[model samples]
Each structure stands twice: as structure tokens, then as C-alpha cells.
Target: MKKLSFSLLAMLGFFAIVFVSCKDDDNGDPAPLTPTIASITPSSGPVGTSVTIAGTNFGDSPSVSFGTTSATVASGSTATSITTTVPAGLSAGDVNVTVTAGGETSAASTFEVTEGTAPDVTTVVDTVVALEDLSSLETAVVAAGLDDDLAGDGPFTIFAPNNEAFDSLIANLDVADLTAVVAALGGANALAGVLQAHVVADSLPADLIAAQDYPTLNAASTITITVEGDNVFANGAQVIGEQIIADNGVIHVIDSVINVEAPAVDPGEPNVVRVVASPDGLGAAETNWTADNTYILDGFIFVNDGQTLNIEAGTIIKGRPGQAARASALIVAAGGTINATGTAADPIIFTGEADDLNGSVPDDANALWGGVIILGNAPTNNNDVGGVKSVEGVPTEEGRGQYGGTDATENSGTFTYVSIRHGGSLIGANNEINGLTLGGVGSGTTINNVEIWSNLDDGIELFGGTVNVSNLVVSYSGDDGIDIDEGYTGNIQKAVVWHTGSTIISTDPRGMELDGGDGPNETAMPFTTPNLANITLFYDDVDGSNLTDAFVMRDNYGGSLYNSIAFNHDAPIDLERLTTLGESSYDRYTAGDIVISGNILFNINGVTDAANFADLFEISNEGDAALETEVETALAAANMVVDPGFGTGATKFTPTADAVTDLDSDDDGTDDELPEGVQNLGYKGAVDPAATEPYFANWTKTWAVISQ
Candidate 1:
């Protein structure tokens, strides 16, 4: 019996061991649960308030914290819900609430600590000091001893540069910090002058500021406020942060410091000559503007019939700031000529009076003067008396401003290596002059290597002309970069358009705004078909700004877009078919009249399918089988990825050899193939990547305003 009992005990022990081993193998201690806070009741409260936190996977004995302070977890807390009391001595501000359970912590959500009462009125100084980003600026203001003036009740508009702006300034000056900045300013008086330059006596909102230049506390200096698209800029500095409101004034946070200094004038150069003309206009004998002198147009200056206006290279011409009747412009009449052929080394410049002949002009200084207008005797769509039509920006009584004729190859004289800036003055409601107005300029004219910067209107407007333009750069124009209207049949090649967001007044800024004609006659004779090639458009994606399409074709406009690279634009190509205006761009493409090939688009918004624009191509001339194959092949080739190596310097658009080879091989449709002067360089975009010679090296290297 004892032996049997011992054997039974051994068997029982063996069974017990097996059970323990199985339990250990199948499962260890329960895995720790991660706490989650799905919802916090009330979201905000004072200290010691009962708050219910609900979520999942909450283990027992969960601890809660409001910001850094620990909270008391109440009893009856479940895995999905917990009740906790807010910690004491918590400050009134935004605090993150987090929960921890079973050695794991959950993510946090913000909880506001409410004061529940009206706070004291804050001054501008107080607001600046309160912001962490403006701490450096606050210290500078205190050092300048202008804190009392800023804190006073009198309203002021202060352009406050943030800490980053100060840091950049310090770096630019080769200094360490704010202390170094103050020391570099020489003394407290010099520092005060610099600070006062940012402050205006009146409280000006964005709209008011954009209207006109405001006098600042700095003597004999003014701050030019500009609005580009949805953004507001003071001088050249962009306003980065929201406007801070205070009891006495408002503060606009900028990304750069505003330094007001008189533009240094050359001692040898003659004093500025104010060309205030009479009602009949200045005679042709006194029309010679030399490079040794600076010419300022106070009113309308016209080059009348049988006259030539000879301007030397490196000549600086300025126009007085005005609008409507007081607007000033240089007009070359129909029979008149302007021999303004500037070299690549010394280009002639037309700018506003505010431009101090210094190389730099604030990008925001626009619409402060009128632009250049050159009228030629070229055929146009809409012809009035004697095959002519009144120009848009000029007055109706100004008969010399009319442009049109039967001549298709009339020369309006030479306009090369010219920089037109701060133009597009408004003469009437919705009527502003373009930067370079070529009204019926014929084929014989030489228009090359021209740069238009910060014009309040279109960069270059061609009205029913056959003038081919090459090596053009248009940047920050208020309207379209290159606008072709009234049946213009020109060839534009090697053009670079940097349309930064929208313009100051006009919201619809495009790389190319092509229109056939303003008419019931949509299919005008020329059809406004310009053979455009090797164009690069860079569109800035500004938040809350109006849509700036790379290309906007409307009103039966049919154009050829070849070997182009459009990057980072909302809509790389936008086609509008106004039924009232008749046939559309798609219609032209379907008819094999509009050629679009070897084009690449990168980072374009809202492009999903690879075959998005495939409908515009003629897939086959024969059967369904051929159509399917051609469609697939063309779509794949057109949408292929090719990176144009964009850099920060003058050679920004130098592409790789592979990218160039891939982009250059598009020769189909139309007998012209390439434009008259453009060479088939076997590369895409404006620059030839494989060439030993640099593209636009001669023209845009140092002379162009945008290059500077």
C-alpha cells in the first residue's frame, strides 16, 4: 500500500510539473497596457477641478498630469475612463494633459487654463516683450530708448523685425548677437535712428499701407508698403507673422530689418534732370538723353513724327509717381524711332524716381511710375480709322498713341539689354500700362535680353505685333509675365518667367496670358499662334494667394508649347474654352494645329492620372490599335521626369546631360520646327546643359536687374 501511495504521489507531482510548464509556455505575466486619453471633459478649468478623461487600455492606478503638475486619479477608474482632479498652483495658459498607466504614457492634448476675467490693456512694448520671437527686437528697442515712445497712446505702425531677422542682420554684419548689433550701430543716437525708421506716426492697416508711401520717424525717409497677392511687405521685407494689436498701435512682424539710407550717387554723373514737358510735348531736337545725365519724366514725353529719341547705354531714366492724368510715360509714336540699343555690359534702364540709381531697388516699389510705350505700324485685328486703334493706357485725345498699319515687318527701332522697373502706372480704372508695351512692333525690331522686374502691370505686352523676342526674363510682375493680345503672331524662345505668387493689385498673375482677340470674331486671321519654345516658369506657391497658372490660353488662342519645363505650379497648363468666344485650346490641339511635346511637369498640384492631358494629343491617324499604342507611348514620354538642376546663383538652371537629351528630342508637326533665330540645341529648357558655353551668360550675368 505504501509503494502504491508513493507511486501515486510521483504521478501527481509529474502532472503538476507538466501543468506549470504549459502555463509558462502559453502565457507570461499580462502585457502592460498603454493608457489613452480620448476625450477630456470641459477641456479647461481652474486648479482642483474634477475632470473626466475617457479612452481605452487604461490599467489600474493611472496617474494624470496637467502640463507638468501631477493630478489625483479618483477611484472607480476603468480601462476606458478615468476621473482626475486638476493639480494646484497651475498657471493660466495652455497646458498639455497626459496620462500614464502600467509603465506606459499616452499622447497629450492641450488644455487651457482660463483667467475668466477681462485682462488689462496691453501696450506695443508689452506685446513685443511677451512674444518669444520678438525678445531680441525688444532688447534693441529698450537700448535705443524708444520704449516710452512706442508705449505711448499716440497710434503708430511699427514694422517689427523678429529674432530671425536680427540674427540674419547680425550674421550679415559679422557680429555675434544683439549686443554686437547695438555696438555696430556706433552709438545710441545712430541706433535710435535705425529703430525710428521702422516706425510710422499713423496707424496704417494693410490696405492703407499699400495705397501710398508713408513717412516714418526717420528724417527725409519713407517706407514703401506693398501688397503682393495676399501678402503685405514693408520696403522689401515680407511680413512673416500676424499683426499684433496693442492699445496704442499695431506691430507687423517682418523677416528682415529695414535700413533707410540715401542711395549713393556718382560724383561725375550730372544732377537729375526733371523733364517736365508742355501740353504739346518736348520737341524732337531736345530728345537726346545721354548716359552722363539722369532724365526724369514729370509728364507725358512723346517722340513725335519724323523724330528719333537717341538714348545712350547705361543711361538711367526715371518717371515721377502719379496716376490718371498725372501719369508719366515715354511714348514712341507710329513713325517715331527710339535708338535705345544698349550692350550686354552697359544696359539702359528705365525706373521710378524712388530708385536712387543704386543697383538695388525694393521689390515692392511698383506702380510708382509709368512704363515705356513703343508704337509701330504693324497689322492688327481690330482696326479703326486708317487701320489703327487707340492704345489702352493712353488718353483718347492722344492721336500719336494709336498704333496699326498694313506693314508686317516695320521696325520700331532697337530695344535690347534694357531693364524696365517699377512701371505699370494706372491711367484709368482697370487700365494700367505694361512694362514694355510693343504696340504693333514689327518683325524688323530687335528685342532681346530684356528684363522686366516688379512692374505693376504685365511684364511685356505685345498688341498685334510680329516682333519675335529672345532671352527675356520677367520677375514679380503684377500681371502676366508675357501677354500676347489682338492676334499677335510672334515667336518667343528662351524665356524665363519667375512669377512669384500674385501681383500687388492684380491677383491673376500668369507665366503667359495668351488671348486671340476681344471679339465676336474669335477666329481672327493670325489666331494669336506664337511658336513658344524652351520656356521655364517658376511659380511660387503662396498660401491663401490667388491661383497663378503657368499658362492661361483662352479666346481661341492656339500656340505651340515645346521642350518646356514648368515646376511647382498649381496648374501647369490651364485651358479655358469660352463658348461665347468660340473654339478652345483643346479644339486646336485635336486639329493638330497646336503642338505640345517633350514637356515635363514636376511637383504640379492636382495631377493624379499620368494620362491627364492625353486627350489633347492625336494618338492615331489610322486604326484603334494604332491609337491605343500611340496614346500610351506619347503619355509616357510627355510626363517623364527630368530634373533641371536649379541652383542659387546665375547658373541656376543648368540641367544634367541626361535630362537635356531626354528633353530635347521633340520634332513633330509644323514645318517651322524651331523659331527663326532659335537653334535646335538638342536640349530642353532655356539653358543647354551639355554646351561648353553657358546659357544667358552674356545677357543675364551681371547687367540684368533680376540677376543683381
Candidate 2:
């Protein structure tokens, strides 16, 4: 009996050890403790007030709640503290603030909410100083000694750059901090000029800002407001924070600095002077510009009515960098003439002020200032009360800026052997000034041997103009190479567009963009029936992801394309005719109103079958066989497989002898049938390969910026 009792005790001890091991295996790890809230900063004020919560065990991704409302955690959330913003629509009272982290809740802390009042009680300076994000800007204001002016202003619209903006500017300037930034801006006086550029006398909200150009305290500059997508930008600086209202003004937080100074000019440079024109417009005096001096345009210089601004050959005009409202441009108003006739050896040059004339500025640098604007009294589709309409990239309220009248034979001026480079400033949402804007220019004007390079917008844009252009060269344009809109009935001959690609931030890039009219006015009178002949468009080696098209024809456009070559484009043509417009490009083609014949499409890439090129067009099968045969015959006659020796300079468009001789047509190199208004150049492309008078070589070689 004693031995059996000892055995039972041993078995019980073994069972207890087994049970303890099983229990340890079942409970692998210990659970975390609940978080605790210690305190909050300043309690709270009202909605949009930033509050800091101090606590313990608040893991990464904590959820904070103020009473029944949720608080937004801004940044810098740690286990010890969490920054948050007070939610809106909360009543003024003491509320309990609780934090939850790692699925664990914390105790509630008391937070007092204050009354929310209108922002009119505070001044602009006080409002900017109160915000932590604008602390740097506030310091700049004080350093510039303009704090008192902002505080005592009657009404002002202030574009205050945030701390991040100041930091970026400092880094760009290779400076240490805000103090260095103030010192680098040439002390307090220069800083004051920059600060004044951001302040407008009127209280311009987002809506009002998109409509007009507002004058600022800076006499030489103005602030231009633009709305792109869903956000607002002031002089390319995006508005990041919410608009703050004040008693005397409104504060808009920007992500970038506005109105930064340009590169300093050398004092020893001959004939270099900064001329700031008045915003009201230039006088009607007869001004003669000589070739000896360099004219620097500082603002919008509009030659009023009865003015004749004569520019001699070899004259160089430099436009200063400024906002859209104060962009430097030579505008010829109605009844004003700009006789800028330049010879090929000494062409008239219009460029940015940054260009040192020593080839320092690259060809891709664009939008440093505004371009030339010539407004005349020609007929247009969309007319105002007195057959006049406001041109784009100009103030609508300015009556003198209006173009369009009933005179289809109106004369503007002459532009020959001129080169416009690095222009086209953005004026509004998707609205930029083109390199050469011919608005309602009559057929009496003479425009020949023009070269536009590295323009921020379209190279040459015609708005309901009857003018004819010849020997045009456009390269590296930010937008389309050529844009014809409204009821333009012009004729373009011997034009060459090379390196056609979209800008870095562009949405649409095309070789040619044609629009008959705006909106539902598809059948607008005198349709966009421009005659284009001997045009050569060369595409860059751009990726397929870019929005690049050879031709974009929309609305009720009626045009003729003859003796043209479209080489290596993503999309050869895109016909976008809204169903509401009632007429389409296909319909126009069927009616024989639009002509697309005698054109050579070579090495056409992107989503197209090279064998059957007719499939690219949206026309019906009524004349499909005939159109296909014509295209094939043209290709064979032009010897499309031969390489057209394209050089690397302005006079590089000299084709080989075999490329010029037509095999099927006349065999002497001329087309069998030429269009009514087009001239038979005896060549397929813009350059006459027969060694005759070449368009680009004879015109653009002397003064155009081709390679260097």
C-alpha cells in the first residue's frame, strides 16, 4: 500500500509539470497597455485651430476624437504627442478630447472651444503673423519695413508665400536662412519692392482674379491670376492654403515666391536700358526705332490709334520677365501700324532680356515675356456689339485691346525677315500669348521670311485674319506649330516645322491645330478655309506617352492641304467634331468643302497601317478607292522611300535630286494637278530639291537661330 501511494504522488507531479508547459505555450505574448492622454496645448480656439495633444503609448497612426467630432491629425504624430486641427461645426463649450492608438483607447482631456468670428476684424499683417506657416513671410515683411503699410491698408490682396516657399528660395539662392535671403535681395529696399509686387490695392478673390489683371504696388509689375484644373495659381505660384479674410484685405498662401528679380544686366552693354511703359497704353506719337540701341520693353506697350512705330533693320527688342498683367509686348492697336521691315542679313530680333546675344540662352528657354500682338479691323465670326471682340491674353476691360470689324481689307503692318524667340507668357487659364498674334489682320499686310523659335505657345496664331504668310519656320514651340482659329481665310506657303513636341507641362501639342469657330458655331460664315501648300512637318523622337498629333481639325473647318509631307508623327490626324456641332470634318470632306490631297505621309508611326493610309481618315467609303489610289500615286511619284538629306542648320532643308523628280506625274518633278490657290513648286515638300530657290535656305539662314 505504501509503494502504490508513492507511485500516485509521482504521477500527479508529472501531470502538474505537463499542465504548466501547455499553459506557457498557449499564452505566447503579452498584450499592450492602453494609451493615456496627459494634456493638450492652449485648449483650443475654434474651427481650423491647430492643437497639440500630449499622451503616452500613442502608436504610429493614432485616432483622436474631440467629443463626438473627429480631429484631423496634421503631422509630427509620435507616441508622446499628436498634432491635430479642431474640426468645424462644433459648438462653443468645453469638450472631451480622447486618443486611440493600436486599437486601444485613452482617457478624455478637457478642451475649451471659443467663438468663431468673421476675419474682417483682423488686418492682413496681423493675419499673416498669426499663422505659423507664414512666419518666414512675416519676417520678410518686417525686415522690409512694410508691416505698417499692410496693417493700415484700406484694402489689399496679399499673396503670402509660406515657410516652405522661403526655404526653397533660400536653397535656390544657396543661402543659409531667412536672414541670408533678405540680405541676398540687396537689402531692405529691394525686398520691399518684391513684397509690394505681391500686394494689390483691390481685394481680389479667386473668381475675380481669374477675370482681370490687377495692378500691384510695384510700379513696374502686376499680378496675373490663372486657374488651371481645380487650383488657382498666381504668377505660376500655386495657392496652397485656404484664403484668410481680414478687415482690410485677404491673405492667400502661396507655395512659391512671386516676382523674383531677374538676372542683372551689364552696365557696359551698349544701348541697354530698362524702359517701363505705362499700364494705360502708349501714346500715338511716331516713334522710330534705330538699329544702334537695344530696346527693353518692361510692360505692355500698346501703340495707340494713329501711331506708326517704325523699326529699322537689325533692331533688337528685349522683353523683361514679368507677370501676365505686366508682360512686355509691342501691341499695335486699331489704326496703328508697325513697319518692322528687316532684311535677311540684318533681321529684326525679338527675344527675352535674359538672352545676352552671345548664345548664352538655350533654344528651349521660353516664356520669359510676352510676344507681339497686332490687332486690326478685319471681319471675324464671333463679334461683339460693334463687330468687335476682345482678344485673348489681354485685359477684356481694356477697350483699345478689342479687335475685329467689318473691314476685310484692313491693313495692319509689315513683318519681314523677323525672328521672334522665347516669348509667349501665360495670361490666364490655358491662355498664353503666341509668338506672333495676328488678330483680324487684313490681306494688305505683308508677312514673309518669319522665324519663330522656342516660343512658349503657338509659333504663329491667326485669329480671323485674311493675311497671307510665306517662308515661315517654327521650331520648338511649346504648343502647336501653327494655330488658325475663328474665320481665318489666310494662305500659308513654304512653311517648315521641325522638332515638334509638347512642352514639359503642356496638355496638347500638334503640328497644326485648326478650329473653325468657338462652340456650336460650326457653320460660321467664311469658315476657316486656309490654303496651305508646300509644308513640311518633322517630328521629334518623342515617346508614345506624349500627346502629340500631326493635325487636329475640329468644328466646320474647310481647308486645303497640298504638296505637304507629314513625317513620323504619333497620330497623323485627329478629327474631333462634337455631335452637337451638326457638321463634321468627314461631312465637309464629302461635300468637297475640305480638301486633303497631294500630301505625302512618310514613316508614319503610332497606331496606323502604312499600307492603307486611307484608314487613318474618318471619311466614308464613297470615294475611298479614288482617294487611296491618289495617295499611292503621289507616294510613288514623289519617291517617298528616298532620304531627304536634312542638315543641322537653318539652311539644311535641301532634298536630294531623286526626291524632287516625280516618276508618275510629269517626271520633270512637278505635280500633275495643282490646287487653285497653291503654286507648283515642282517639289513634294517645302524645300525645292531641284536646287532652285529653296524656301528655308533663302529666307531663314541669315538671322534665324537655327543650331546655336
- For candidate 1, the clash count comes to 0
Candidate 1 lDDT over 1-708, as tens digits, reads 999999999999999999999999789787787777889997888766788899988886788887656778899999888998877544455778998888899999777766322112211211122122234455645644546654432233322222211211222132334444445545333422234323333333222232122222233344555544433354543332222211111122322223322223343455667677564556654367888888878767888767788889888888875555557789988888888878877788888766665533455456657889998898777633444788878877788889978788998788888888778776644678888888888988888888887787788888887888888877778778888877788888888777665343466777788777656545656567788888877666565565457677777677777777776666545555444434655456556666667766654554434555443223221224454455446545654444455654555565563665564444453334555555554667776666654444554422233345
Ten residues in sequence with the least summed lDDT for candidate 2: 118-127
Candidate 2's C-alpha runs over 4 A off are 1-270, 273-275, 279-281, 383-387, 500-504, 542-547, 577-579, 606-652, 657-677, 691-708
Q: What's the TM-score of each model vs. the native?
A: 0.59, 0.64
Question: Candidate 1 regions off by >4 Å?
Answer: 1-269, 383-387, 502-505, 542-547, 578-582, 606-641, 663-672, 675-678, 690-708
Q: After superposition, how far is residue 155 of candidate 1 from its true place, in Å?
A: 12
lDDT of each candidate versus the true structure: 0.63, 0.64
RMSD values for the candidates in order, in angstroms, are: 14.8, 12.1
Top candidate (lDDT): 2
- In model 1, where is the ten-residue run with the lowest total lDDT? 118-127
Tens-digit per-residue lDDT, 31-129, candidate 2: 776999888897768767888888799988899887766778877789898999887644455778999887888888888877532111111211122
